[model samples]
Target: MAADLVRRLAAEALGTAMLVATVVGSGIMADRLTDDVALALLGNTVPTGAILFVLITILGPVSGAHFNPAVTLVSALQRALPWRAAGLYVVAQVLGGIAGTIVAHLMFDVPALALGAQPRTGMTQWLSESVATFGLLLTILIAARSRPQAVPALVGSYIVAAYWFTASTSFANPAVTLARALTPTFSGIRPDDVPLFIVAQLSGALLAAGFCRWFLAPEQAT
Candidate 1:
């Protein structure tokens, strides 16, 4: 059991690290290649969605591919994961995400720990985050229940859509939001705004979980 937990933790950390690396790295690459913000966003979006699909497909069995603290929290609330393990998962994800930012910075020959100056705050952004996370959790819950095999694809697709639709570009994940704050790049968010983003995400996730509990309940035989 101990060994299994260790493996799960490692998988979570590694998956989150790779996810953040792709996010930050792609943002940097896109920024360098384009003066057009829309095009740069497109460049960032595709790679992020693609990487999520790949990582979830490859690591799903190992750690359930929960690279987000919000996901982990919802799972724990649903009793799909133990609380202790869920706490550890969040820790692993946050640290791994930060490491990923550093790795991306080094790859692009920038300082590793620059604080983000990009201001990603305001009511619109917060509401967008809540909506983004609500949709994400709902997608995962419904897909996992109805078509377990399609969860990865559905999640990847949802994120792709959310990026274009949401005001905050659908950061929906707390670990990713925190990690992005460490990068002063196209994908970065201001560190000052991280707390509210996280709160909105968690609120959205919890709300989704609550809604699904009733919506997804098994029909009682008459």
Candidate 2:
């Protein structure tokens, strides 16, 4: 059990690191390649979504591919994962995500620990985060229960759509949010705004969990 847990933790860390690297790296590349904001966003969004599908597909068997703290929290609440393991998962994810930011910075020849200046805050932003996370959790819970084989594709697709639809570009993961704050690149969020974004994300996750608990319940035989 201990050995298995260790492997799982390693998978989570590595997976999250790769995920964040894609996000930050793609954002940097996009910004440099284009002056058009929409085209740059497209560049960032496609790589992120593609990497997510690839990561989740390859890593899901090992650690359930929960690169997000919000996802881990919901899984623990649902008893799909133990609380202690969940805590470790969050730690690994956060550390890995931070490492990813550093990797992206090194790749781009930027300051490794620069604090983000991009201000991603305000009521609409918070609401977008809440909605984004809510949709993410709900999609995961429903798809995992019903069509487990399609989770990678479903999650990737949802994120792709969410990016275009949400006001905040759907930063639904706490670990990702925290990591992005360390980069002053196109994908970064202000350090000051991380806390509330996380709060909104967690709130959305819990709401999804609660709704699923009741909504996905097995129908009682009459």
Candidate 3:
């Protein structure tokens, strides 16, 4: 890899690490502070959203702030990111996500890797994941085109809303879903259930990408 590409990959890894830390850490904090599941969820939702906006704002210029594999995949398909670089980005993201989860667990004095016991399965959960991921990708696609500066807040807002509306709590990023499976926290998903969530997320991301291609940027005739 070239020096520039190496730097960008490092940025992706570091940013994704921080993003996962923010999410898992916040979920742990919320679970500790509240008996009410609603209040705990609210606590989890707010910080995760806030952190996401901040991460994107700070990292956007460096590596396009693509902390999600689904987003990266779509970007590659759209020609925004080259396929080779996208593959590198996915590797970094997955590694960073696992490291971040371990860090969060350590910080909270929890086990390093827990295969989440809670079941996040079934068709309804899968559907919810699809919807959540679709909305998230669509939000990024539209905002990035019309108001580039607003992408951070727009994405944060959409995710915050999705957390409540979707049964899967909007695990829109495959990296995140995989990392969350290692935690026995409020946000954790069972390891066995990760595949379905990933499949749903990918499907949704592709659908959004296709829609954006058709409507937002129509193909030119040969």
Q: Which has the greatest lDDT?
A: 2
Better of 2 and 3 by lDDT: 2
- Which whole-number lDDT from 0 to 100 does residue 53 have in model 1? 93
Q: Model 3, which residues run further than 4 Å from truth?
A: 218-222
In model 1, how large is the Cα lDDT of residue 195? Answer: 97
Worst ten in a row by lDDT for model 2:
213-222
Superposition error at 155 for model 3 (Å)? 0.6
What does candidate 3's lDDT look like per residue over 1-222, in tens digits? 599888888888888888888889999999999899999999999988998899899888989999999999999998998999999999999999998899999999998888877799999999999999999999999888779999999998999999999988899999998889899888888899999999999999999999887777543332
lDDT ranking, best first: 2, 1, 3
Poorest stretch of ten by lDDT in candidate 3: 213-222
User: What is candidate 1's lDDT per residue for 37-133, written digit by digit as tens?
Assistant: 9999999999999999999999999999999999999999879999999999999999999999999999999999999999999999999999999
Q: Give residue 190's lDDT in candidate 1 (0 to 100).
A: 90
TM-scores, one per candidate: 0.98, 0.98, 0.96
lDDT of 1 at 1: 96
